[model samples]
Target: MEDLILKHVSLEHPANQQSHETEGLSSKHLVVRRGEPFRVTLFFQGRLFNPDRDSLVFRAQLGGLLVKFPATFSKPQSYSQWNAEIEPGKSVRSQSVTVTILAPAFSPIGLYELCLHILTQPRQYSYRIGEFVLLYNPWCPADSVYLQTEDLREEYVKSDVGFLYMGTSKNVIPRPWEFGQYEEGILEICLDLLKISPQHRRNWQKDYLCRSDPVYLSRVVCAMINCEDDRGILKGNWSGVFKNGVSPSEWSGSADILKLWAESKFSPVHYGQCWVFAAVMCTVMRVLGIPCRVVTNFNSAHDTNANLVIEEYYDGMGKKLHMSKDSIWNFHVWVECWMARRDLGSGFDGWQVLDPTPQERSGGIFCCGPSPVKGIRDRHLNLIYDVPFVYAEVNADVHTVIVQNGQVLSRSVDKERVGSVICTKSVGSALPQNVTSAYKNTKAVMPSNRSTDGSPRSRRSYANREEKHTLALSMSLDKTPIAGETISFTVTVTNKENSPKILKEHINAQAKEYNSSPLETFWEVHNLLRLAPYEVKTTVHHITHSEYDEMLLGDGLMNLAVVMQDTGSYERVLVTEEFNITNPLISISMTGNDYVVKNEKREARFLFRNPFHIPMSGVLTVMGAGLLHKKVHSNVSLQPGEIMEEKISFTPKAAGTKMLHANLVFKNRPMVIRGFTTVLVRAT
Candidate 1:
């Protein structure tokens, strides 16, 4: 272990200091003499195991001030590789790092500190070794580069010398990018681009072509504002865009504009991910002199369910596919661009969909065909329903045309019927591409549960969308504690509409259902019962433990937060609660003078000689307050009827009354018990 500490960190003076306003902390001072270059250095003092053999690494941060400051670390800079190494028992005296700060011509510099951090490798024994920050001052600069790129090819290779993933080979190729082509049918709700000139529109139309084309970046941008495909339909992947736009002035802002643009087109959903949209937007923005970046997610909005769609044009069964695995599926992409204002802040940031489109409707008229019509009112032929096939191919002579009501002279003519149209029409042009199912009978296969690895009994991943009966629910906590001292909640569901059947499964609801079902989808659907319109039905549920919940309580404070968001629309509702274990006030009476500590590391001892009020069982949370350790066992079933003798050890860092908060949950009632006891440690 190294005894490292921050020796010197400060913001040098005379720049410009805002007076101290808040308590204790003073106002920023020493504004970098406007336009003058300043130097900031952080000194580190520590006892390292070995200075000669051990590697020293450091990173300097200016705390997010937009300046032309060039920062250098005493230790080499390598992003994905380890930077420092110390011998097991050697020692080092001290080290220092320097950074040059150049204030922008338009910037108003003030007092600001620099933070430094030391890194350590993880090991079996939990070790929190060192954390320290060093402050430093920054002055103005004559003319400094805002962002600097380092030639780190050698460092990158040396530190990252290993067999890389196969997919990394794609980096060797430099291909001309295509932009904006995916936005053919995207629509942005908040934007009004109706008056954009036609010439600009034509330019934007060809923007998504090869970047090597001779078109100027500005011309392409003019075209981007006008390229709109009205017929394209996609899933509501870009739903969050309407609410915000991008801010280009801030470094860490969000990509709201890009989100709008991306969501406007269904391309994000059409491709099963937004990669095309994000890529095109980023490329277009870069060409337009706007800095941009791309973000990718393994599981994106397109395939929220595991039932992911991979793009592939069918070319017989056994042969290799044309598209590569990387381009097919498994990857989703989005773009972040410099904007004037982020949706949430003024930081130059925003996101938009490269391919925007309207949300596709699920339930629509899937079949439609032309109907044969005879003389008006002669005999209404039921060709639409009875002979739906006849409409697929209509005969010219069989079809009739009549004159309009206001015609001076009545006339009738025979029009040529179009060729056989074996067409299957849905309500929207942008319906989701249906994939061939691996199993024919979903009901039969659903019952034969199996894991993704083909295990005998596996949990099922549900991807249903029905479950919207009453459009309302009531929640109540069960009096009976199901597990531990926790209560269960019962939600009563009801439906209002009578025409449509209530789907038992929960479906993902669209934020807006201009074309499909109105109800939103949920991950799990339970205790569903059919009820008449305006009737009410209830469901009882117990909160199950999730890995995240366990992680929350693992810390000192147990924080619980629930976010109910409209996934289709991206609307959110949040509920939060916190439980703090501060002071356990109850008193604990021990039978013996000196208690023996056991393997459990608790100080409590229970002898089989005494018969307690009753045997209790639920959950067990063994903890040592001063020792900073806690263990929670869920759904614990304790057998107290047999003779039991146990000694628990409690080691406290400080001599005080440590509290133990105990809770018992039962079917009929739940009880909470709190107790505390003093711990004495022998003097060494």
Candidate 2:
């Protein structure tokens, strides 16, 4: 009998050999979907023997269990030929055998040890080839929810959502032009997700996606995006400790962030606020074949306790005090994944909330939801996965109290502010979709239980307008002012009183974050004006860049407040207005299609006309994450009324949504002209 020798081993997908090469398949481990055919080619040599005298048999085992398969003798072709050529001798006498096996549709999702055995007359030779991982196929008939054909298009497959980071300090509401584009890096994220241990993958496959229990998958994904666990990919940072000078809002897509995180070997991702976290989560879900959209809630409340009330304290001078555990963000973003909730049964299907932002902890981990939108809308606080917390975000009432030396001077209730204007990107479009009605009732339903003081129950409304008070106040800007230009606004205060009274007016303008407290006073005016009964006065305040530059916070959003006190009655009325200091505009136009494959070169042109009388000379800086290298061109000169054009070429390093920014600064003035464009990088 000839000694049995295993000469060459290879795997082949007979259907499409070239496509498998691009897929980066490995011989040690083969990935296939359930109900798919797995084929492999093996070459072996033996001494010459009569066909009838010697017989060879093959067998396979997974987890030490016998897996029956069919084998046949055939010539090596496709990928197998490449393996055969790499061997020492091309003329070696050997028999090429092909094995075809079918993974059953009901096969568990995991890595299975595949063993090939060659049986002869006296003994059997066994070779441990590799592992076979069977994954859940959403396209298969066994899947509960099937994605429609249209969903495979680039719009749904690759989408973008706007995030309004109005800043935490001021209310100057800038346009919601900042968008998080998702795509490109999805494949890498998906591959990382599949690297989970075999047992964990098997459990998720069986207990989650396979059973149509998307809530579990949603929860897992929320935890995996942030570095709260060892399994998470991106370490989140909200403190703005980025190595680059880029702000958290400069990130335009999830792909670049994930790519940077991966390139950094799983280090903390820089400057990710709430919107960044939610947008990236949307990309991961969509890439894994789960339908998802990013949702933004204006005036979103973070109720530390379960009570649906947010208590805010203010001093006698109208300065806000952080005395309560509850707080309301100017805007908070989260993702809504579309899946059938097999765990919750009927009405809970459709959109479910999944917030990846590391806010409050849930079940000892910093992840929230798969909280059903239906549960929140129906006020089912008892449901699982932080439904009550989410409900408070949209339905809670805000109580603003003015206190002095721990004494309550006055209290005001705002029922319409919290959880206003919940929106998402429309399907197949970039327009905003009003999803507020989906989270709450159309008609206001007062809570059956009232506070001990017999006040109206706290309820949320989708209306845009605020209710008017007895003392009407209005504000307007003189003109839309750009950065470095003077900003001026007029505040008109009216008193609706029957008799003449002495009024102490306090008019203050301060730089603030979009959703938080006031930072520094940009301009202030205080005076005691004696007015006739039902008198109205308008005051105009002007702020120069020299006066506000150092005090201006992120994005230069400012809050203007007018407070009037009736000295005799100690009654105070307050009104506020928010506006943004515009930045100098530089037109940025792309020369080619904004969407391109990874490593493909694209070009953009930046044009800016010199507004100054003198010749302006400075450096033009171009930057982007994963999209372009930081490039700076010095000695950029522009004459008065001359349009300076600079073209930049970039090759995207990763797939996904990306942003390109150009900043030009003049040596003469403290003026910066900036422009940016969003691009979609697809992975081929």
- Model 2 worst lDDT run, 10 consecutive residues: 79-88
The residue-by-residue lDDT of candidate 2 on 259-278, one tens digit each, is: 77667766657667677777
Q: Where is model 1 poorest over a 10-residue stretch in terms of lDDT?
A: 160-169
Q: Return model 2's CA RMSD, one decimal.
A: 9.2
Each candidate's lDDT (Cα)? 0.26, 0.60
Against the correct fold, how does model 2 do in TM-score?
A: 0.70
For every candidate structure, what is the RMSD over all alpha carbons to the true structure, in angstroms? 26.9, 9.2
| Residue 193 displacement (Å), model 2 | 5.4
Predicted structure with the largest TM-score when compared to the true one: 2
C-alpha lDDT of residue 41 in model 1: 45
TM-score of each: 0.19, 0.70
lDDT of 1 by residue, 576-640 (tens): 22222221122334445553232224456433211122454443333333432443223433343
lDDT of 1 at 15: 32
Badly placed stretches (over 4 Å) of model 2 are 1-145, 152-213, 229-231, 234-247, 263-265, 443-470, 476-482, 514-516, 520-522, 578-586, 590-603, 608-644, 650-684
